[model samples]
Target: MHKRTKSNIAVMLVLALCLSAILAGCGHEPDKPKPTKNVVLISVCSVRADHMSCYGYRRQTTPRLAEFARQCVVYDNAFTQWPKTTPAFCAIMSAKYAHNNGVLRATHGPRLADEHVTLAEVMADAGYQTAAFLSSPALAAHSNIAQGFQNVDEVFVGPRRAVLPTIRAIEWLRKRDPKKPFFIWAHYNNAHYPYRASGIPNPDMFVEDQFYDASRHVRALKDPRAHLKADVPRDHPCVMEILRPDIGAIHTWAVLDERPEELDFYIARYDAGIYSADASIGRLLDELRTLGLLDNTIVALVGDHGESLGDHNYYFEHGRFPYDATAHVPLMIRQPRGAGARHVSTQVAAFDLAPTLLEMTGLTPPEDWDARSLGRLDKDTPGDNLVFTEAGYQLDYMLAVHDSEWKLIDVPNALDRQMMRHQEYELYRWRDDPGETRELSAAHPDQVARLAAILDEWAAPWRAEVYANWTRNQTTIPTETSRQLESLGYVGSNSSEDEEGDDGGD
Candidate 1:
């Protein structure tokens, strides 16, 4: 009987050890947030930071987002790695440069390669439900922009609206698995070109009604010969009665010379578009709050790129220029339970977004990412402050580097050099001349050489690899996507050495 009692006690001790081992295993993963915590990423296409109310614009273009910005960490000088939609997003999602990620243009471009792990994939692997609602064909599944998203809802149907995607996101959040956290991305194309802000209360606040009088204003293509002129008379009448969805890039610039006041109408329309998008975003935030997810959700807002409103004569376009008009964008992050709500004024790149999201969610970002998390900025970490921007849509390929006060745009393409009167480099003290009106490359030779060397050293390796495999990496756009891009004015003729052609805005 004593022997039997000894064996039972030994079994009890072994059982106790097994129980403790299980409990310790559970406690080891305490760093990861519970499944209740969620993440929401909101991206707006072609939103210029300078045009937003929160950014000090005269008009209240983003009333909803401006209020929302007060509760978030706003990056005032954020720039995109690439100004085009596909390349910009690829850089953001992969934490890599556009050249390295293999997505160079919005259409007829290389898709995001399968090897690059995206943010959605990371969150999904962490047992979070990952989804994306996109309005642009640039982010279509076939383009590989939907790489890591498990559920993707694409709206390619013409007349893109932010509300469509926002509604889809709200619906998905309502029906998501309650046991798992969610990582959702909602991209709005309402701020994109052919700005038609349907449902916006007052989109024409800054413009006179006479500008839209169809009886007086006519929509007609200017003589192809006048495309390059910096100024033309009112007789040219570059203003269009109804801005067609597929208007050419050069035509918009022609408006600057003729019917200049009419530009306000288009600008107002753009602002209205922004306001409409803000409302849709407000609705999404409301849904999150109603569902009791706001307390646990991390919300982030970013612009893929900005639109040029007559900046450097690239009116109402993007992707072709390396100017701040197209490169600077808005970035904001609202942490869970309103933690870390402050403004970060230093320079930040869109590629930094991946690591920022990862670190915020209790996951360690990979050390090799090209950009670092903005958290380092919040903590005043001493790190690289130089931000880079590249352009390869339709114009000559260019590379730009920006420090806190200086910006250098290096246009190395031979065609571009000849076209710009043999001027190959442009240096702007952006803080003083945000318009980039005064070219100072000749005056600031020292600054130009320093930034040019940095850009060349950093880009040489990737540029060589990209050029060598450019043809192989290029993907054929699906038929429907091609149609959508064509309608959106992205599928236009390329510029030639002899004559300035369409800007091929994306």
Candidate 2:
């Protein structure tokens, strides 16, 4: 009887252990690894936030971008540290001010120093497949603007639109390694100067008045009698005999004389360029969606810097002034799965982009970077942050200190001039006077003093460091690069003797 009981107990115990194992398998499964997210960064040159349809422009210049804005975390008051392409991009990629990053001027500074780790390097280190497709010749590999990117293509160099880059980016995406996450940067120069409005089949539809093509304007400037046809009425500004071949110079001369009516045509052309860029961006996004990667990829769109558009007597150019028209740019980030869509009015700088992107992608930004990540922005965030904008060689090292309500433009040109005894300051209540028509430096002495002190404290160290190593920081511009700059109407010297005629560094 004892033997029989022992056998029965053994059988029952075996069945209990099997049941426990089955229950454990059914109740809880092991944790699966999280999928890595991909990233795409899109940048357009010379785009003014106010002129974009998504940013409250009356014109529908960026219908596709406006649609994209709905899926993005749009930053309404974002600003760039520098107004020039190379320096601005340096600030964005290095998460450091231009002066600190060693690329303070376009076509002049040494390629971004290898010492500072770039966003591409970080992404690459984090196991990302990095690539950069840029449309600006100024950003060619020789300039080191594509630092740390494994694959780079600057085939469509010049002021071309986003078409070629978009196509190339799509092809790269299709052929990229499916197992590894990728980081792709596509920079478009469509909205930049000459404002040719090229990809649009019918630009006249976007213009309020007659469409004046860029070539027509250029021809008229070269030889008024032969090129300026009767269509260019006597009342039109282009009818005037301007010796300069660059449209920007002629536009500056005309607008300064209060002949701004013709500017409307140019503005319309600029809008059309934005429209072309928007369409190209739309196509790229559509491709992402088609490939089943839209939800998994983070899409970041921004303007490297804003165009002057005749503001502050700086026409059709940037990097010459630190006004809001040139400093304020469009910044939007489409989070993965279209999450976190909201407008952030808190002031932010281009440098913040690097760290923000790094944080969003689950990577850690370098501890020594001068930027703070904006990934945690919310509706109640304070707007008290001070954003700084620095001028390039064109402005003789000017700086603008901005707060939520006031902006102070400090031009220390006197330091370089033997005859001048005092610095120049221009203060404006930017909130109430966005146009900045009324100067307040003379009226608000206290504000100027306070802001000036802040500006000097913030800029002094960087300025000292930059000038201390000026010779080592300069680079020789290649002949082909000079030709590219000339084609884009961005060639000139940084000599005070030729300051009156110099127009290229920016």
* Candidate 1 overall lDDT versus native: 0.72
Give the number of colliding residue pairs in candidate 2.
Answer: 0
TM-score of each: 0.82, 0.79
Taken over the whole model, the C-alpha lDDT of each candidate is: 0.72, 0.72
- Candidate 1 per-residue C-alpha lDDT over 40-141 given as tens digits, one digit per residue, 9 for 90 to 100: 999988889998898888777788888889889888889999988888998999888877777774456457888888888878888889999988777876
lDDT of 2 by residue, 34-99 (tens): 338899999988889999999998888899989999999998888889887887988888888877
What is the C-alpha local distance difference test score of candidate 2? 0.72
Report residue 67 deviation for candidate 1 (angstroms).
Answer: 0.9
Please provide the root mean square deviation of candidate 1 (C-alpha atoms, Å).
8.4
What's the true lDDT of residue 402 in model 2? 75
Clashing pairs in 1: none
Clashing pairs in 2: none
